[model samples]
Target: MRMCSADLNLLEKWTWNSRQNATYAGDLTSDGYMSTQQLAQAWKQKFPGLLTDNRHDYLFKFVNDQRSSTTFRAFTEGLFRAQEDTYDIAKETDEKLLRPYKFCSSWVKNVEENNDTLTQLRTFESKQEYKEMITNISLRLGFNYDIQKELVKHMYQMCRYNKAWDVSQISPWCAVFTKEDLKRLEYAEDLETYYKYGYGTPMNQQIGCTGVKDMMDFFKIHVDKDTPQQPRSSVRLATAPALLLALGALGARRDSAPLTADNYHSAVALARRWTSSTIAPFNANLAAVLYKCTPNSNLQINEQYQVLFMENEKPMNLEECRVGLCNYTFVKNRFGLIADNCNLDFCNSATKTTGLIGFTLLFVFITKLL
Candidate 1:
């Protein structure tokens, strides 16, 4: 019943408009506004059992909900307005909480800006399956010539966006591609995501430990039962890249081999385990819950356990504990090193250069010094 979201304003506007425009049959008065009792009855009819029979309860809930929305809007607007008054790009970039990856020079250089990271992505686009998809879609749409990859990608995105916005209506852009073709396009995107931001690179996992460490520290305090000044639960809104890094830190949904063009057809079976559609989809969430278990006849004292859920399903199992519920001690020991230190030196150190060029540079530097 408690709602906090970035779309609060939109939701409020939609709710207000819907309520104002809705026909309430006999509930409306001559003045075109319903009494408290009439409004309650109308809400009860519309939502069925969600609203109580008492008009006072309805009014109280409405007022509190509106207050929450207003407070949230004011807080967010105030923060942004303050930022606008004294905007400094450098200062903003230096904020670790806001831009954690920007602090890691090596990650910024080797991963974020590296052209080599897109090797698999470029290869996938050049593959026969991808080219054929473009050709087939063009022919299906009555176009004389084959459409470019960018055009197809744009159409695919439009189809996805339109479908998400209104599920009741089918998008015209989606008509260009068949179900099979959509799957291929989805797979192509999966390759890009996996390589660019996922467990394909070790640096991602290393950087991800920073977030995991904070989560572990918070959970540890709860397990120990020491009263804290902070809120019981924590929520962080992060970008897709940050989400991917956190997934890497947790070591979840990783395949034995890297996703590449060679395994495009073969990796279809592995899609269930490693596909981006499931791993990093829109509004994706990863959560860990701590549960206190009562002492049974086998034990004398109460115990605390933890369960990690990805999108509401417990998908990971730790070797030290049971399938779904992991022992606190085991969870602590397993990720202790990662949680303690993310080995930030790895981010500071330059990646090793290779081949004749590297040796030539070293030789030239030594020769010049002598």
Candidate 2:
């Protein structure tokens, strides 16, 4: 029953952590060798959010809708109990206990062999990731019926972009004119379009406006000459979501062609009026923006997003296409500071130009009018 200190330590470690599945059944929910009962008691006292919130994720993470609604409702009712607690539980061991659940090869192999619906799902970059995700979901409850059709519609719309954009989905000259994406779009729509874009937004001040100086003011790095290892001043970090919003707007694209690698640089060069990185910045912003979800993954991942989609001019306009590809509405909501009737997307009014000498400078201008 007794052992050396090192042996005791390893035993305690394994007892506390399964070093695998993050589920409650694993050990390592605590410091070491803490029993499941002790871990559960600790969780009850410390992390209440971990209890109720994980109910959805635990069942949904790799689960599809297999159980009936009645079953789900009952599952939730019993599964979502929070015991009265005086403190939060720091189940540090729980993190290590659940790592094994991350990869279930058997689950994937089964989907590949037994699931025929997996074939109907679309692929991106010839990889099996998206289809694998769908198969995993189908394995859960409630996905037994017409889920295939739903996924088909979703894949064709969000994951394929080798052809010209549907004009109704974008603005004039906004589509990048990709041959592969539009061909796929055509097959899906029976050579028909959902909408149309006859007249495009006025070309004046669409993207390049005067706020370039203010936007750049925020990018400067402060340093200490004495130590190259660390900066004396704080590096105020900003999010890239705002940049996505401006690019997502109906303004930046032209009716002439899809925003491809050929034209994105031109668009960025035009946008240099308000930012620092030039064409490089434009490409970086597109990469950041594309990572977010869009309604139209069917378009293409590598398809240049610099062009906003429009209606009638293509299958989906660039402006509309932007919304389809990413969820940037929250960032756009922050652009309210732009003057009403301002010709451009936004002015970055939260800007302040601070000089090393001291006084902070503020500036505002009509994007198009000036």
Candidate 3:
């Protein structure tokens, strides 16, 4: 008892409180340990996030006990160890910075392997083909048809934005794509072919959740690859400006019509030169664009929930799906693209200014700034 720390003191207090002034301390539990209800109530107060008031919550499952002294002792020890281990703020901040990478990597792998929408991307060939695929997948996955085309199309547009192409034999020259595609055509040789066909976006969605620090690291990777041609100053100077300029120079203005074959073909030609090495961050950006084309509809949703469900086995209702739509502002802020007011003006202006300066200083290294 003398060696028992503050946690033990608190545990004793909780035990006594649970007994409600009973004469004997042994009255806390018939088995001489706190009951599940007592442990749950204590955990709810101490670790509210871990244990909701629901009958079968996270902590209850974690401890795996209706009546067990082992779980109680482990829980008590964990809290004490956590408190003792987190003394340095700097260390905690470093861990916080590194945490998202682990989360993003784990999340990306899970979704790529599991999400039916993304998986369906590999087999896509034509609009009709995709519609049929979606119909089948919806039936197989227990998704209702009311949300079928909407969900499938959401993923379809993202695939296009990511530079995936229609590789089906049905229409080899078709510029327009559906949710179905055999392979992404993002790595073409000619500018016309590449712009028309290349999956110019990054290989994965890891970009959607990264920050400025991660962008800097990404630049470092390209710098190491392009050492003789790419100087550190040039890399830093060109990135932001190049993105702004490419976006500004975009020729095709968005329209209200559902994207037609003609519309897609023309848009790709107009923005052919406007390429991205890492298009993952643009997932949210593209979602924002699609939302404008059709606001307040299911088509406007981001892929976060789609990806999240791949890692988590928890079932979600349709209402929950509709309610939990990811906001454009939220996504931008998550990736350090915006500052206050959820406005892109600050970031855009800064990038444009820096891009111009960088362009002047590093003219030779100015190939594909974004």
Candidate 4:
């Protein structure tokens, strides 16, 4: 189990206090009370590698465990000299050191792969350049796990988007994408100026970056038609164990009793829900509502299937309800907020008019009823 930084800081405090105080101060007892000295030494012995390299991270394993408080009774024994002095340590470690360290460590481990894509990517000066290179590479090789590093890089940048998205402060970003990214993007439009950074075709073209659909078209024309071998399995070697663990966590009990067919289906659905990038859990219910609301709706069987898995529906914000792939006609016909045609200008105008009219009609209807 990986340790969190919060737990690590607590362990560090205990270790510091234990070193100052007597090693074996507490009286021995049959109730299994561990002294401060005993606890630190036990942890050191248990995580020999962590103690040598990163002791705080090492101690996090014990502190994070649910049984740690019960098992390591010394932690609860209140042996620390003072709580006030140690407070600053917690605040500084997380923001100043641990987060950056974790980011850099993840980068080094992920980028050192024996591939040319990564090697060439490191030469790029800007994120836009890197993205263009990735788009070009995908055009040639078809999408595969080979582009995982680039995906990670995009994820890192996206995380920082709309905030202090400065990658220059970090070593990995400085080395890979240049060291002058501190100046935040001027606006949302600036951030999404590239078509590659946004979704779908029209926006991708308008934004002047390659869209995923372009990659799909290229793969269809160049790679998929030429491939003679069986379709490469989407499932990777690392997938099964994680899936099993997820299943176990989600309350599958194969050890106690055999899983039913329903149980298997439910588990698979859960996995799909978790893995889906476009279709959110709420979108499933939204689709169901759309299907029920629209009279003789034109939704495909697969589209309907997208919503049927959900048993209950939650309220979604207007933006949240707006999903990709599904046509606007269903929503427009039912709510009259979306335009009949899919043009952005018409859609935007109709959305505002629909909201005003819908609310005003409701007010008038209620007044008349009263």
In terms of TM-score, the best-performing candidate is: 1
- The residue-by-residue lDDT of candidate 3 on 1-34, one tens digit each, is 0212443343234321233233432122332222
Candidate 2 per-residue C-alpha lDDT over 115-169 given as tens digits, one digit per residue, 9 for 90 to 100 = 4312222222123433443343344323553245355444444322111122223
lDDT string for model 4 (181-272, tens) is 22111111112211111221122111111111211222233223443122211001111112222222212112222212122234432332
Give the distance in Å from residue 341's predicted Cα in candidate 1 to where it truly belongs: 2.0
What TM-score number comes out for model 3? 0.20
Kindly report which residue pairs in candidate 3 clash with one another. Answer: 124-180, 124-181, 125-180, 125-181, 163-199, 185-198, 186-198, 186-199, 241-355
lDDT of 2 at 357: 18
Sorted on TM-score, best first, the list reads 1, 3, 2, 4
**What lDDT is reached at residue 148 by model 4?**
56
Task: List TM-score per model, in order.
Answer: 0.64, 0.18, 0.20, 0.16
Clashes of 2: 95
lDDT of each: 0.52, 0.25, 0.27, 0.24
Give residue 230's error in model 1 in angstroms. Answer: 4.1
Ranking by lDDT: 1, 3, 2, 4
Give the range of the ten consecutive residues with the poorest summed lDDT in model 3.
356-365
- lDDT per residue, candidate 1, 129-209, as tens digits? 888888888776657788888999888876765555456656667666778888788777777767666876777787878
RMSD to native, candidate 4: 27.1
Q: lDDT of model 4 at residue 66?
A: 25
Candidate 1 residue spans exceeding 4 A from truth:
1-95, 226-230, 267-269, 295-303, 312-323, 345-370
Residue 158 miss distance in model 2 (angstroms) = 10
Better of 3 and 4 by TM-score: 3
